[model samples]
Target: QDNRISIWSVGDLGNVGLNGEYQGEPQLLCDIRHNGDVMDMQFLDQERIVVASSTGDVTIFRHHQNNQTLSANQRWEKAHYHVDRQASCGGAACTGVICNNPEIVTVGEDGRINFFRADQKGAMRTIDNADSSTLHAVTFLRTTEILTVNSIGQLKIWDLRQQRNEPSQILSLTGDRVPLHCVDRHPNQQHIVATGGQDGMLSIWDIRQGTMPVSLLNAHEAEMWEVHFHPSDPDHLFTCSEDGSLWHWDTSTNVSEKPSFLHQGGRSSTYFSHNTINQSVVSAWLSNDPTKDRMEITNLIPNQTLSVNSLDVLGPCLVYGTDAEAIYVNRHLFA
Candidate 1:
């Protein structure tokens, strides 16, 4: 990430400031109205960021470190939309995006998944109706496989190598129907993933074992939105919810299991969940920390409340955005 090219918004294409630390006064970099609200964005490399919008458009912006400028390199329109076997037309809104080097994959509200090459102007491949409901999130299981969650609370693994549009494996949340909002893979384990949904519930799925979740817990009072693992500290995790709370989970004590790798399709893969989590699934995994086992949660902001829409962690620092159109930044998260 370019430190200079810092502040941006998801709800609008408003004026963005280049320097995040410019507290004295704000400096505007670019102010171009986007096609629709920006849904997601990902780093293509150190130099470029690709942004996906609700209007089914994805744009790549190149940050010129030397000049302190950002330039639009390319844009793909209607990359994800609805089209039946009969070629029926129905426009769709883009929901999720993932970047794996030269390949770009995007899923949309129309339940379609599209793959593109950064150099190409349009989608090279399309999986129509990847889900019957809105596809909310997607992540890569391997270079040739992708995992996606839908409004129906179903998680499916799509094998890109297959000639068909069907997924190779599917996992259901429960007997009840609750929309899944976001999904994140474990930083250390390959097959482990945490899914948060509309009912304020969180579940962990071990893809190699089967479609069933290893553990489920009531994580929030309202709908859960985002989940992320510490980049280096696999023993910890963070989650945000519409209930206006941020939760920090510590599972250091439960992390005693030996690291194991599984082989499938002739490829050896490691579990993303840290050692203890790789083998066991407990409801309150956070309470395992021996040093501070008594206090498992620390509300990032205890005095006031606002629905946390998104949040992320990087080492000791944390940043979150709320529905009130405000951003909170905190340092020394682990401290």
Candidate 2:
């Protein structure tokens, strides 16, 4: 038997026998540690995994193939250095992006965007610059600009070309000061951006105009968790919330009726959770090819003592890690 992560077939534990799926001696993929809870993760190509943890550390791991299974080759602990005193990651949390090369872009709990690049020998570069705020979400628009949202319901666009003190553009919500939870740019139109906030609102803005949005909608009843633009079209988009709802919006149509459900043929596209421990659900894009719709959800894996902090998906397999010194690369649920 291989001393790797074991795989068990679905059923009661009593049903696990010698004929089960655990005998192949699967490889021990990797072990990722976090000081606090992990908030998000991004994979760079097929070999690296980037993680954003609640302890304000953004780390990267290299994947190696051994015995026909994947395992971690190397790791970078404390990938993003925090400016504030080392404390539990609170307020607007940090996030990572692999925009152009192997640069790790993370928004700090202190409202700064830090960049770390991979050198020729794969060592991460020292953080070059940091922008301010309790930055909730940070992402790239082209290679030179990044869009970010923060606790004060303000959207700021940073021009990396200018080594300056502040962002090139700043936009705030018109009516209320609801902490923005997520921000994204339209996949087709680089000038357009969308934002979701604690006020259960979604708004679209064009940088050509001032900070106020061109289109706004009360997208959800509860706090919005995430929002994304369609990979192929700027007209369509998706959003999810704590209220257990997923909405599909078409920005090209009547702005008053922008948000619609993603259910197919009058069926729900999501499952409802009864308890709070498993209530927080996170979704990530496995592929953004625009030719295919591939996505995956990561959460606590039952029966494993460690808490699942982050996860990734490739084809029909789910790769995840836990708080108790464990990482998993397992098969996904398929029809």
Candidate 3:
């Protein structure tokens, strides 16, 4: 249908094209992007797209130019640079970035999440800090807190309530044998958050606690890549791994004396990415709750064959970048 939006992916070698169910074949919209490799591309609402490169530069583009042959609207050189060195780094280096309402936070191999305020002035600043251990992922908990996870299995929670300061809480996955690969917080409740580590572990925590995790759920059979919680449900979570699988779990189901492994068998996959979810599915109560139990049922979309290097979800749609120099837009085409 013409109502559906078109999807596009640009390769590291500068091959940019579109992917979708259009006519007899997919279409190539244009080849305007000129980076040696597109390290990370994020859509801000529907009008603008931001692309980060391995050269430690950032560029902003308007989604659709009036002329189809035209490329992105405006380009900037060395948008994100190390305050100390003022140089560029190579590909596959930027680990995490989050576009908070008015600002954007990005972290690269330098172990710092540089902050940029989206303004007419277009100024950049380092508003906060995290543990300097290979900042793998960074996200905002509500608007005031920033949750950052490093390669060392440590989760740093920075309180933006305090202006331009370090984190107020530092939680480490020290007891677990694996290093955390990704971390995500509950969209509705700032108190709850989840982490996925190298050992295929999914540990959930309450932000108030000093160090103890609320629960540890082994949701995958291999090294876990990412963990995502349903946008509206605090108890419904998803995990993906190199094991070529995506697992969904309802934390409420663990209330019974029965072992969690029986429920752990629920797995789905289309391509391997960081996290997955459904928008309509809201809160789900634990099975044994006195009130009626609510279950958020999400169908697992199939994944592409290339190793998924990065994955992100917005509402019902998911965008993932793979090691094969391709990105995929996996929509619920049938369901």
Indicate which candidate wins on lDDT: 1
TM-score of each: 0.79, 0.60, 0.67
Give each model's whole-structure lDDT: 0.72, 0.53, 0.55
Question: Model 3, range 68-128, lDDT digits (tens) per residue?
Answer: 4423554444543445434444333555667764577776655666666654344465542
lDDT of 2 by residue, 18-129 (tens): 4232223344344434444556656665666666665555555555544333444334444444543344433344554444566667775655566767543333323224
Scored against the true structure, residue 323 in model 1 reaches a CA lDDT of 82
| Best candidate (score: TM-score) | 1
User: What tens digits encode model 1's per-residue C-alpha lDDT throughout 140-228?
Assistant: 87889899999998999999999888999999876887899898887656577888999887777778765667667667889998888
Model 1 bad stretches (over 4 Å): 1-32, 83-90, 257-295
Off by over 4 Å in 2: 1-35, 65-98, 120-132, 251-335
Better of 1 and 2 by lDDT: 1
Candidate 3, number of clashes: 6
* Distance from true location, Cα of 37 in model 2, Å: 1.6
Question: In the order shown, what is each candidate's alpha-carbon RMSD?
Answer: 7.6, 12.1, 9.5
TM-score of candidate 3 on Cα atoms, chains taken together: 0.67
